[model samples]
Target: MLIEGFIDTVRPSRNYSEDSVGRESVHPDQLDQLVRQLRIQRNDDARCEVKACTSDLGSAVWDSVSAFANTSGGMLLLGLDQESGFAPAPGFNLDRVRDQFVDGIGDGGSPGRLVKPPSYAIERGEVDGAPVLLVEVAENDLGSKPCYVRAKGVQGGSFKRVDDKDIKLSASEIFEMQVALTSQDTDRRPVSEAEIDDLDDALVEALLDRRKGSKALRGAKGRAEQLSRLNVTTKDGIVRLAGLLVVGRYPQQFLPRLLIDVTVHPANEKSAPGEPVRFIDREQCEGPLAEAIDQAVSVTARNLRTYSTVEGTARVDHLEIPREVLREAIANAAVHREYHQLFQGQPVTVDVYPNRVVVTNPGGLWGGKTLESLDDGISRCRNQTLMQLLQSVPVADTAGVTVEGQGGGIKMMIHEMEAHALDRPRFRISPDQVVVELRRHGAEIPALRAWLGGLSTDPLSDYDDAALLVAKREGKVGVTDLRDLLRLDSDDIRQLLSDLSNRGLLRFIGGESYELWSDEPRLRTSDEQVIAALSAESPLDIHELSAAVGKSPNTLRPILRRLIGDGHVTPTAPATSRSRKYLRTR
Candidate 1:
């Protein structure tokens, strides 16, 4: 089978019209194209599901309702037969099926109500003269998440769409969604398993001394009252999770996984074999958050190998990854990680490779922040209480300065890396975690220049060289990546990419992305893979082709050029435009 995993399944047609409620609904003629796509795939996908409910509506439809609402919204098609290549079902009753679906999703008190807080738009469409019902479900907000079947309740009925399947959500996942809706700080919650005496005497004294200028400490009558006023203790004298994490003598006794783990690998990639042991050094730092951050940094720094350079006739030695970068990366991971009960078992990790160091924490960007916004100094605190406490809790051996709480850690890391003439740290973000990779500036320029020297006779500009390097490293380079790298506007980047594609140095990879061009024919093993992928669905661009073939666009460019020359493929537009696409030649 062709590699279709990288491509999103066919989307419902966008031909839309406003309904009585001002919501956009799909037009009836749109069903024809959608049906053809469904037939070609011969299966359902994440965005659209097919059902052939001809006689009556049942529990299956409600399950999809919950799944679509809980995850990204999707289209639910009724009277479509999944068993027969999604053809219109035999003996389908369009009006009856549509009425039943409407009643089931209505507000409370409806006899057929199946879901809570219904959010959908319905339309009646026909394909091949067969009537069909299309319902577009909307995703619920955090407060209304885990939208479940009314009969099954949230625990048993809640479902989320994972690819083509509707999977039941775990209790912990539901609890996390509920917790996220609350206005209170999650770290301020009392740790019922922890005691007041769990707070370390010296650490607590240090914290109190640091906060001496605060009005809360001055207004308290005694130590207990002082701790309570400072949000370190609940009214019943139980230690709060944030306070325990900051000053508790043994916070891990109650929350075992709230720590940092560090590991040093022998090579750049984990797949490198022949090593007797997986890690050269491994250690888990526990105790309070401040101490854990410090220890993790120390362990990672100590394991690193340094290099020397001459400055002003003097030899200067520098750690592979700077000490400040390590500390900032570790501290950010500890402070910003999600504190919800669902993620309590997951610990922050720092992995040291020969060429880079990767630090990961159990949470993606919170509060709707985007990766592009990091350079803008936009900050969102996932753990406000923990951040507040850390703002005053000085590092153990520092000169009276706090660890890090001003929301400048990312900016500092960027500045430090740029100052050293190293590439800015790269971030990998997902729903489960956020990882930052600090790469060593190891001969990248020399290697890229050496590679480019053979590609062209004319001398290329520095920006062209930089863009090619990015495209080679990252499978493809997009307008956004170039903007960040070159500090150029969208139009300039587009023009530059077009010029490169014209000069045969880069290939436009659809969706405003480009990759390096190649001319080696012996390295064209992906010829069949590309053909197979396009055969399944025509008119895929270099971006989709590269992702599907699991090769860089640079690798596919030469193959595509040869295919077009041999009449095996055709371009949808001129090669200069970023939107140019390729398909099997008719």
Candidate 2:
């Protein structure tokens, strides 16, 4: 389902009736609550928009509406003004403006015309008792896309929300949208520029040998037959882009952007988070997908750390980031990248850094995927033919180990990282790119220690200090977990985490329940026997709190009383209370 449908599913069933205003009465929804949640902040992105009525509201406001519909559908707040940090529009006349908007989005239209086939959900709500118009636009059916403004035709009026800006559709982009609507799989598109002879014979032979070993395809016969069976190429000898990319001598020679660019950068201590970056080792892989993934991995491994640690008997070598992760990232990018839209100068880029590696592929999450949905390990291939071709290249030693096997890639990547004692990889989406940032915790100790060393001396800053100190002691920190230790609310925890991340003290791991604060917990207590287990910020129930500290509540009573009497601790309840929980006195 599209994002709009997903949002709609969460909205409770509402029976509509005509209000005096003649508009369909939308039953109670979180729209009012949503207004309250986002009233004070200004973050207008692809998923959100804050529109204050202008004199020519129909033209300007409708453009954003069309942009939202053509791309991912988003919430449209009409009475929210950016000048006052998205506060309710000043001197806003709710009834007149709502009527104007209702008429503007009308289908049998003319007076206040906008949106060709009006497919927007408008709700009247209030923010701080000031009426706010919340309009939610649904993404158009892929076939009838380029949801345009009434004045300007589809070619001129179509707009897509890219990051913060609503970019007008170029001629090529409009064409691509049409193609995307018509075609379910882009990889099957034939490469008219290339011939049958363009594909490398050796790679095809190797693939055939691999396929012959697989139980599913053991009976598969000739090269052409195998390619046809796998849907890699057309039966009429028209080489598909997928077939060419998988085994062609040079895919980029025909398809210029069908390649991966690998860059390894030297560790720069002075490079700020937001700055023009520089690279040391640069290599471009334009060969067949089989060789390109291998080449990219080999080049990246040069800069990656391979340190040794002592086990019980001897030393064991450990590469900071495992090779399987690199293969999975690169292979996935090549197999599933958007091919309908021409790659505008940006090839798939793999940036190798000291503490982390960022692999960026051009194209947002494909087929209506959000980050949470992608984490569910569901596979949606943007390029099915290419994926089929990739699955043919079997590992030499492993009898039936093919490169492009279906599913489990994400699970494998996660499991590999965890088994290596590293933080899980994070995935982020943008209008033009999909970024995967994988970090190595063992390599981040030096940076954590440096940040800890530069701790501010002032006494008033101890709260921040205590947070970081605990992070330095615990590998990761969650806000709710710190409620007792810091006596802070949700807002305070959010602000503290933001501050630490800004100051480069903590790296943020993904969060939903509460923001998890991440850092290296290498700095041990003076005894140094083991890493310190983190204490709760908010006092948990007795059993949970005791388990966190690895001691029974009865055993901790004396320690709790002593600390409370000494003014270092306080009990939320009476001393004899069964529900007693302790908080650090800060």
Best by TM-score: 1
lDDT of 2 by residue, 1-586 (tens): 1224326633321122226232543334455445444543346667677777743254677778788878777766677787776777776776666667666766224544544443665566666667766666666765556677878877778888876678888765566555543435567878888887898887788777766666645566666766776666788778887888787889888877767888777673324566676667789987887678778877887778775444446666556788889888887776666776456356888888777888888765556555777657677776766776777665434554335455678777876665444667888765446888888654564564345455532221435544665565565766765554555687887787777676666666658122224343322232121112323377655576567767777865565655556555657898678887766555
Poorly placed runs, candidate 1 (over 4 Å): 1-33, 107-115, 190-197, 219-224, 235-237, 263-281, 298-329, 338-343, 350-382, 400-404, 407-586
After TM-score superposition, what is the CA distance of residue 317 in candidate 2 from its true location, in Å? 1.8
How many Å off is the CA of 50 in candidate 1?
A: 0.8
Model 2: lDDT to the true structure: 0.65
lDDT of each residue in 1-586, candidate 1, tens digit only: 1112111322322232234321333454456667777778788888788889868876688888888877777888788889987878998887677667766776323754454544676666676777777777777765676678888877899888888899887766666555544554779999998887789998888878888878877778788988888889987798999999998998999999989999888778674566677788899999888888889988988877665444455666667567899988888888888888878999999998878899999865666555777657666777888888887788887755445555677888886665444678999864457899999755454454467776676666656766776787787888888776666788998898898899998886578987777664322356767777775246888998888889899988888888877677788899788998888766
Q: Who wins the lDDT comparison?
A: 1
Candidate 2 is scored at a TM of 0.63
Q: For model 2, state the Cα shift of residue 143 in Å.
A: 8.1
